[model samples]
Target chain A: MKGFKYLRNVTTLKMDSGKCINCSKCIEVCPHHVFALNGDKVTIINLDSCMECGACAKNCPAAALHVDSGVGCAAGLITEWLRDHRLLAKVECC
Target chain B: MPRISADLTFADRLGSWRVRWGIGRMNYIVPPGLYAVGRPNSDSPVLVTANYKKSYDSVRSVLAERDCWILVLETYGINVWCAAGKGTFGTEELIRRIGASELTKVVSHRQLVLPVLGAAGVAAHKVKKETGFNIRYAAIRAKDIPQYLDSGMRTAPAMREITFTTWERVVLIPMEFVEALKPTAIAAALLFFITAMLQDRNAGFLAVCGYVGAVAAGAAGTPLLLPWLPGRSFAFKGVLTGSIWSIIFYMLAGGSGWSRFMALAAFMILPAVSAFYALNFTGCTPFTSRSGVKKEMKVALPAMACALLAGIAIAITGMAI
Candidate 1:
């Protein structure tokens, strides 16, 4: 945990202000404080800090938020890639 | 007791099959679309989830006595977090499942509660646009569901927290050990054989011991002693522990007169091996972030490589002398 920094730029989380009803649901739900409210509008202050957990998008009533979230583990990714490439069977452990 | 017995028997069969064929099947199929539980009424709360059997079972088993309607989306046997990351657990799937199951007719209410972790994949707005159903993200774990339902569907402070207690950490060890066994055994055996050829045949015992110690220090010690360890970095903690073990082994094995080079080699190699494996343990921890892990790897990996190279050089020089 100390040496490795999380790979954060891969997220697809986006906030559309037009769809945002200014609901603070995203703010309350985020474990990483990825969003903050600015005068009835939600903004992504720390996109890189996001683990892509999708808490905000799930709770957003206005449907203004979107993100690409998933397990970021190397083992999980390798297995997924292998399965996708048909190099390995659909197995839980790699 | 009877249910527990049945569950145990089923788990045994699954485990044996998994071991024999090397095909992990613990998380298999789950029926997609909305399912009623315990004769739920139209007004029952709709809980949405991925079609991963483990996730489905965890939710259903927890809510056994309660009446509810489960809306399971097609996640292709992936868990919520992974499915969300891959977009299999996203807005399109939710909308498609809703239409396919005619969920609107099953439930009188328009609100659907989903796992908080599923938010990454699902676009709440898209689901609403397609099905007119509002999404409510629940607490992190399914165990808090009964309380959430009782408390007007509001997540309490306790419910929101994710804990990695000792028991939880311990449970993770088995899977870690299982995953590591193949590589660890192969490496240990190769080292054992090589050591036997280079030195006394009994040297294989030392080699196996060293390899096993490195694995245990990295995989088991780091997680169990996570909070107590001196460093914030897992690799550092592992290296530190490994260094201590190497010193203890050196003292016990009476390797003092062997050479200064071998002493240095032992110190370098053991810790580097431990560090690499410990860094890999980040994937298993809960509090680790993607950015945090990447940063650790950048610094730790180079140090590990350097140490390993230095160790190899020292060992070769000692052997030649």
Candidate 2:
């Protein structure tokens, strides 16, 4: 992770302050430390660092957050899409 | 608590069987619509997700104790980032789902919580314009959903980092080894045959060992030593390890009388092969970007090719003379 820097900003995460209960559930689930607490509310201080794993939205009780989290690897996605289209033989890499 | 349907069990069984047999992991497509989980109240928070079964299940399974509404969108059985890349998981889908589900009729609140990875697919501003529900991008993993809700929807820094731990690295080795085995076996067999024909039977066995060892060093050892390897690039790291292996093989296999040319050939070729296979690992790792992989391949490929060719040339000359 130190030497490798990702080119794709593949995270679909965004937060609405109006609905945020400031429960900080996003902080606990995320492996990347993408979010930080700003007083009683949550902040996406490092939005670009997200890998879109979808741990936060599923855990939020307030239902005040949204993200299109999923696998971010290009090769994995291409293989998945190809299988969906029936162009390539079925292969599960994950 | 709302009971999980029998259909879910059937689906889980099928998913696991498929995975075991190396079949494509089936993603169940949920229609882009809102549905209640555990008989939630109208005021319950709305959680958003792609229609991929794995993503849906991960969210639902984690939310078993809570009551909420799940807004699933058609991602064509693909996960969020990939679906987003293809535009299948986008603002348009979210808006359509919101309208079709009559979400306004179900919930009084205007906010929709979404997975962070879906940002590449869904445009928050467009979703707001087309549908009144404001998008809130949440944490990256499903396990943290409960904590997120309790924290008033706040995210901490730990929730965002992506880790590739030793166990994670170890789990990936099986598939890589399986994939590489066919080619490695073929290469080893060919080397064995050639060496046996040109030299002695013992030489043939040693050659086979060298080839197999190089493959292991490159494909398996390199990945396992990823964090500790000296060089930043995978290829360099692999070559470093392979060279050490080559030296060990040389001392054990009686290369002392060997000419400088042959010894040079051994050093050059074995490590290059190892490095090439190790460099291929960029596709497997989480940290590598497409651009970075391309950059590494551009420089590493030609050098590997040259070294391999030079080694072959030296070996042939040594045998001829």
Candidate 3:
């Protein structure tokens, strides 16, 4: 995560500060240290560092965090696209 | 109250090796339930993990000296990180496992130490509400579990961090190489036959070997030299290495009499295939994201296809000439 910086602003990770309980679950669970406790609120300290693994969103007690997370495999995406277009009857492979 | 041993036998190492080589991958699973690691007692800490044998073995091997209960959730043989991503290692499974194993009856403490990576699937609050057990997200790696437990059940900052060292990258190469075998073989055979039809058998054999080299450079070499590679995008780094390999291959394989079209084709095809394979390796990496891979595919896929097609067309034209 230190040397690698992928595309910017591509992650769907968002936090609802209004619903945040300041549990710091996001801060604790994030592998990339993307979240930080700011006073009484949790803030996205480094959005770019988020790989969207959905740990924060899944563990959030108050349902304050959201992200569309999945495997980042190109072959998986191609198969999904093929399935969507009805080009492949059944697609498998991760 | 099923007692399980913590010492890893030779059989365990062999089994893990077989799985790493892509053998018995689907069936490489341990039964999902509670097991005692190192003569654990009710007062000992409980650690939640996946049912994958590799994951189980890794966790238990590290706790050889510590007395602990391992609560393995059914993940259908998938590793904790991937299974958690798929939600198989989620709250429902944890609750189900806890209830089935009668964990409360066996363990005095209500705290379950979960791998930090598994935080993706589990919610501490929901599990607490459902099972009355608090989920404590622990070390990212099982090797740190001893220290974590020793330090008053607290994970040090180093324990929480994930670092992909050269050895970490190297260990993944065997599986990557195994996965590439079929495709590389097929491509090599196809290239051999096609080039034999166009030129001579000697030319075909050399071309096939060259192509295999390119594929290996992409699939294995790129990952081994990841940090030092030139570009941020894996595709670019692959192509860079690929181009260098292609040129060296051409010179070594006696390209003096090769038509300009053949040279062009070699340059284009080798790098294109290498880039494609390298780009696919993004999925295997620790840091790559779905969004980043999607962005890369959107741009690189079409380009790879075009380059490959053009290279083939030029190769045929050169042969005809």
Error of 3 at A27 (Å): 1.0
Q: What is the per-residue lDDT of model 3 for residues A1-94, given as tens digits with 9 covering 90 to 100? A: 5666666778888889899999898888988888877888788888977888999998888998889898778778888889989999986764
Better of 1 and 2 by DockQ: 1
lDDT tens digits by residue: candidate 1, B13-95? 46444533325543476678777766688899988888876677667766766788888889877777667767888888888
Model 1 misplaced regions, further than 4 Å: A1-21, A32-71, A74-94, B1-23, B251-258
Please give the range of 10 consecutive residues that has the lowest summed lDDT in model 3 chain A.
A1-10
What's the distance in Å from true for residue A39, model 2? 15
Ranking by lDDT: 3, 1, 2
Q: How good is model 3 by TM-score?
A: 0.97
The TM-scores of all predictions, comma-separated, are 0.80, 0.68, 0.97
Q: With candidate 3 superimposed using the best TM-score fit, by how many Å does residue B121's alpha carbon deviate from the native? A: 1.3
Highest DockQ against the true fold, candidate:
3
Instruction: Calculate DockQ per candidate and list them.
Output: 0.26, 0.14, 0.73
Query: Comparing candidate 1 with candidate 3, which one achieves the higher DockQ?
Result: 3
Summarize candidate 3's per-residue lDDT along B224-247 as a digit string, tens digits.
888888666888878987887898
Error of 3 at B99 (Å): 0.4
Clashing residue pairs for model 3: none
Q: Candidates' interface RMSDs, in order?
A: 5.2, 7.5, 1.3
Instruction: Name the lDDT value of residue B51 in candidate 3.
Output: 92
Query: Considering every candidate listed, which one attains the maximal TM-score?
Result: 3
